[model samples]
Target chain A: MSSRLLSRAPQDTPGTWKSYLGLGVILLVSAFPVYWMFVIATSSDEAVMSSPPALIPGDQLMVNLREVFTMQDVFFTASLINSLIVSLAVTASTLFFCSLAGFAFAKLRFKGHNVLMFIVILTLTVPNQLGVVALFIVMGELGWNGTLLAVIAPGLVTAFGVFYMRQFIGHAIPDELVEAARIDGALTMRIYWTVVVPAIRPALAVLGLLTFVATWNDFQWPLITLNGTDYPTSMVALSDLASGNYVVYRRVLAGAFVATVPLVVLLLVGGRQLVRGIMEGALK
Target chain B: MALTDVRHARTEEPRHAPPKRQRFWLHRFDTKTFPYLMIAPFFLLFAVFGLFPLIFNAVVSLRHWHLIDKEKNGWVGLDNFTKLASDTDFWDALVNTFGIFVLSTVPQLLLALMIANLLNRKLRGATFWRIGILLPYVTPVAASSLVFAVFFSRDNGLANWFLSLVGFGQEQPLDWRAGTWSSWIAIAVMVNWKWIGYNALLYLSAMQAIPKDVYEAAAVDGAGPWRQLWQITVPMIQPVVLFTVILSTIGGLQLFTEPMLFDENPAQANGGYDHQWRTIAQLIYRVGWSDLNLGYAAAMSWALFLIILVVAGINALVTRRLGGGK
Candidate 1:
């Protein structure tokens, strides 16, 4: 990791014009669909469907936005609230439980640690969706069907989350620091809450961002569990809107833009952190 | 040294006369119990929600279980598997999955490598460009599918609209999501659009981790950028490329939301009117949920799981070869 700092762009030569042109094209293709979505969202219903498609934003933004906000069948407003609540709940539980378990696995000496850690890592290869059939039945038995808890509980602590947290805590806190706490007569939980948690805030922040975004953007399970609900999630609601009308491109685009707004805002706020987190995650 | 040895030996010896200590069960301070308790939630949940269901699915797949009617359930043994072997829809879905996986993943990886190579250059606003490219990834699948569906539509769609504007292919309109190839191509576009930049960023990061000194030394030896890329960069990032390929394999096989939502008829998770794009994941859903054939659906899931495992094994073998056969 220090190689970056050590070298500091060792080949920081001037870029040629070809590089800029190529980058410009890449950027255009990357961002154009999003820009086009914005345009269609604000375009008149007729202009949106017209041949050659509206190249620029039209003046229907206020109307379509209002329609999306008020659309009952699509349940945009209610779904947004549901998404926020469920995502926050899942994120909170994941952060707390994954970190606690990570601290124990990384720092504490205990029986079955190696075996348990192996199991955890092995579980990473088994996609959770593989167990969805059983999970569905379990939820039904627990009477968690059609509830947010179905979504929240299953995702509360993921194997990858544990692995990630363990990696982070392993690198961040040294054994000597932990031993010092032990000699100071601090209980395990006390030491964890005070010294360990504060020391690993950056890693935690990355995990928290990833967890929240993933939970927010999750679909299939939510679609299965929260199906037929007036309020499932904004993503599901967008799908609902898309499928609801025959050719309501304006309203659909409007809802899509709304669904994407939070994520875009999140990017603008913590894009660098997200990129770093993803990089760190990829390395692991 | 003598004094320290004596002290260590004295401490090593068990003390017979002990102070008052807490009880094992009631006090609960011994044997690192806290650590066990802390890690228990994940295991417990995985057991109940993950492992149990997986095992149950295995058992249930062999039985003639129906969702609505309990009396119809009976031991069917390997009937489900045998039936799936002869099932044309299953094969078609599998073919479609593989077709799309290859179609999208190949170009995506190549383009990603090219983009990574470019991004490795000294460019201004590199961060902005990188983040901007990843925007499609952050967009919810359902939302992006809607936009892509609109773009790929036959009538009033962007492709045909542009074709007409350019005075080309006006006679035969671009029906982007009708035929087998067309539907796969359209879905591939969406998949590639969502993933290419993310993959590029990954490659870029891997490239960044590669020391520039190697490139400079290669340059001193008169290697050009193109030569350096194929010889140095590609080989260095082969592991990442392999990782993404395997990951994309797993993901592409499970392709659901885009194909599910892209069709005009949302009910047709079967891909299209002709079932040209129904993925294995969607097949599982159609069999289990729509057909109410729980046993068959479970069987399909197991089948899909086995295929993924086989592919993963192949991936491991390939990885070994990549590591110089060590």
Candidate 2:
């Protein structure tokens, strides 16, 4: 490892300008649409509708935002809060449930453990959206239609989260540690709470961040469950604004831009962890 | 403060379970009941939400379920499937779904591969580059698609504006959402934009995990960058490639939000007015929600599920053959 580090150090030589230019162009294209979104959000209707549309940002961001908030009976603030609530609740429940289940699978083995674990892994292969037909009908039957719970309940703990946590717990914590905890008269649940949770916190963090981002961006199920209702969610509500018969393009863009700021901040904070979690979930 | 108090209390022996009968319950919990309880939520939830829906959907597909008399269930075995066979909308949606999938996934993966290679180097600002590539992945599909819808608007959208700047589509600003192929292209662009960075970073991380010694040894053997990339990088990343292929395959038929939101009608989930780009998912939503034909929608759902399974199964077979080793 030390020699590997030394050799990797020599690779720290200044990168050629070609590499920079290549990456620069890629990043620009990758990020330009988002920038264009900002440009539209802050521009006037005449400006947005101008021939050879404006590339530069304009100063009507607050004005358009005001228009967006004022147009709909659905307040933009309620949508934001609803989105945060759903994402955070799903994240919290998924982390706790998946980690607990993963620890049980990894450390505290019981009867039918392998079979249950196999089922968990197998379910990962099945497409999740296939259940939507029944889920929506059942949601209506249960009077959960247009409610966030209809969306949240099914997604509270995912198979992928369980698989991810199991992998992390299996590798991170040694059997001796679990055995030591048990011998210390720590009950099984107690050992998991004290030992497994802290030991697998990094994986927990990764799973939590990924789940939050995924739930935040999940459009279809929420779109279905919350469809044709005035119930609040950022994405569904945004689509409502977008598809309105006589939507103000610039104003709707402003609402979209406003809704994206939190996610942009999340990307800044959780970006690297998100990448690692995905790779580790796949390869590790 | 309250959490710490609870933790402190948990460390002490439980005075609540003082009776011998209660002690047995605690022992059972610590031994046999604990693990099952730990994982029960998943199984319980899956049985209710996952397995039950799948099974119920199969049954729902067989019945004549309509909204007019929602509670009335008339047995119509294989009738729904027969309708699906002749359903032009189903076929059109099927073609569009695969078309969008191929257009989006192929280019997305190829570009992602190239971008991953560029990002694989031990370069400065690696974090920044990773974040840049990842920015789109984090953006909500609704917001991004809404932005793209605006960008691809009939006349005044920015896409046409830029294209016209290059003297293309100058005489007439292309109405993106009206045409069949053009609408497919527009939706494909949005899908690719959202996923390319995500796939690239994943591929990048997987590439970084490739042993450094392999590249060094190949370099010493006079293998140039391109040669080494083909000879080593591609072969080594085969599993990850396979993984991405499977993921993309599964994600393909589930394509809903981007096209659903990118449509000209804005809120139209059933593709567009003529159903030009109506994907299988949108078709299912249309049948169940708009037409209020639960049986037909359920039938379509199962059919879509079958398509996914068959396509994924075939791909997995080819991938396994090419992958030689796990």
> All candidates' lDDT scores?
0.81, 0.83
DockQ scores of the candidates = 0.44, 0.51
Q: Which candidate has the highest DockQ of all?
A: 2
Task: Give per-residue CA lDDT, model 1, range B152-268, as digits (tens).
Answer: 889888967877889966988878878899889889988999898888888888887887677655664555567667777777777777778778878877888888888786654
TM-score of candidate 2 chain B vs. the reference: 0.89
Report the number of the highest-TM-score candidate. 2
> What TM-score does chain A reach in every model?
0.92, 0.92
**What's the CA RMSD for each of the models?**
5.5, 4.7
- Off-target runs (Cα >4 Å) in candidate 1 are A1-14, B1-31, B165-167, B315-326
Q: Model 1 residue A206 lDDT?
A: 81
Q: Write the per-residue lDDT of candidate 2 for residues B41-143, one digit (tens) a residue.
A: 9999888889899999999999999977667679999999999999898999999999998888889989998888787776889888888888888888888
